[model samples]
Target: MTALVEMKDLKKTYKMGETYVKALDGINLTIKKDEFVSIVGPSGSGKSTLMNMIGCLDALDEGTYFLEGTDVSELSSSKLALIRSKKIGFIFQGFNLLSKLTALENVEMPLIYQNYSHKNRKKKAIEALEKVGLGDRLHHKPTELSGGQQQRVAIARALVADPPIILADEPTGNLDSKSGKEIMDMLVDLHKQGNTIILITHDTYIANTARRKIVLKDGKITEDVEVS
Candidate 1:
């Protein structure tokens, strides 16, 4: 299988007046197409930093990152933005939905960036919502839905673009056990449909749900193992 994401000698640093902090230090990793992988680490372990690099949300100080065979680290800002819009979908722990927009409208937001026609955006958004089992909640606002439902809407928004890779950051952090399980199940179903899924979380049990686990500590990967 082709590598969906590839990082080599990745390094990120932040200046703190007198000293510098390494968010990611000499990290190398690869995630292949249609693989479900989890990145687990304690707080400040640089997992989030790695996610930012993989998602093309931030630039690294050193190393090369290739997304779908394109060297993203060398791309211009405009090109990077285009890659983000077209190649990656992000799911956040906070559910990141606008309070005022209905679920359907929220899902349609990404399509607007792609300059899709209104009718086409609505059609794609409806299909995404239905795929996540939110067909009946399309008209409801985020506040009107439960925590799980709101997250479902977020998932719908992520999938609406039909991106090849899904990057989820702490996707189940705020939900109850039942809801978290449901969300994980939904993600598993998505992986089964041939999407590459990279999940970032601090929870071991949650990380185990993926077929492969990468453990990070102090800006380095300490373990990369395949689960049964």
Candidate 2:
């Protein structure tokens, strides 16, 4: 597999009151295309910071980050937003769906930024919703859906554009055990279908579900190992 993401000497620091917190400490890592990886850490372990760096949601204090060969570390916020919309799909723990939008409409959000015509967007959104088993609920608002269903909508929205990389941050954090397992299964199936998935979670079971796991502690990677 080709390298989809690469980071060398990655570092980020935040000033909290009188102390400086090192969110990422000289980290070096790489993720390949079609690989399923889980980044797991305890609270304050810099898991969120690392995900931000990888997702282009925030810049690093120091390091070189190459996403499919493009150096994104120093790109302007606007450029980073473009890269995010074009190259990455994000699934968050909170089902970040618009309250007034139906499942289909929510799924079409990403394509709107890409200037997709209304007809094409609707067609694609329906297909994505169907792919996630939400075809019957396309017109239902988020408030009318269950937690799992809402998350399915989010997943549909994330993949509607067919972005190469999926950055899922605690995707199942809000679901029940069964729903969480279902979501994880969906992610596994997605991985099998050739999407590079980067999952950020603190749950050991969830972390082990991936093909590889990277354990972080004190802003540094303590272990990088194959799941078996």
Candidate 3:
């Protein structure tokens, strides 16, 4: 089967005055459909750069990227936006929720962009919130919920689109241990349900939870290991 995501000799560099900083250097990777993978590294290790590349949020300076068999590096900006909307769901550590919107409303925001009918959007939002165990809290705002509950709202929003790939960056970084574990369990369940997940974190324990772990150092992949 073709890989869900493929990168070959990917490189990204940033210019700071007269110096050029390499964010990602010659990264080659393949993530299969429905596979749970984690990219872990410390600061300046290029984890974020790799995630940005895979998520189609940034264009690399060199190399090629194929998403679900299409060469994304060759796509236009408008096409890239369409592909991102259609293929990827993003979950961030900060919970990126609008302060004034209720959980249901926030989850419905993505559907709004997709031009979903109001009634259908509500139905899907409710189902997604419920999936994250927040059925009773749909009416609450982000400030009204606990940290874990807030993250759950973010997860619900990510799932609301039913995208094939879920990209979570430092998903548990802001939560307490109990809450972090809960979030991890939810991710594991989502993986079992056949959603391809790519997690980015600096935590070894968190990285180990995935079936495959890719370690990065100094903008290069240092190790790629599959756990049994």
lDDT of 3 by residue, 37-100 (tens): 9999999999998999999999989999999999999899988887887788999989899999
What is the Å distance of residue 106 in model 1 from its true position? Answer: 0.7
Worst 10 residues of 1 by lDDT: 1-10
Evaluated at residue 158, the lDDT of candidate 3 is 88
Give per-model CA RMSD.
1.0, 0.9, 1.0
Off by over 4 Å in 1: none
Clashes of 1: 0
Report the lDDT tens digits of candidate 2 across residue range 34-70: 8899999998999999999999998888889999999
Clashing pairs in 2: none
lDDT for model 2, please. 0.94
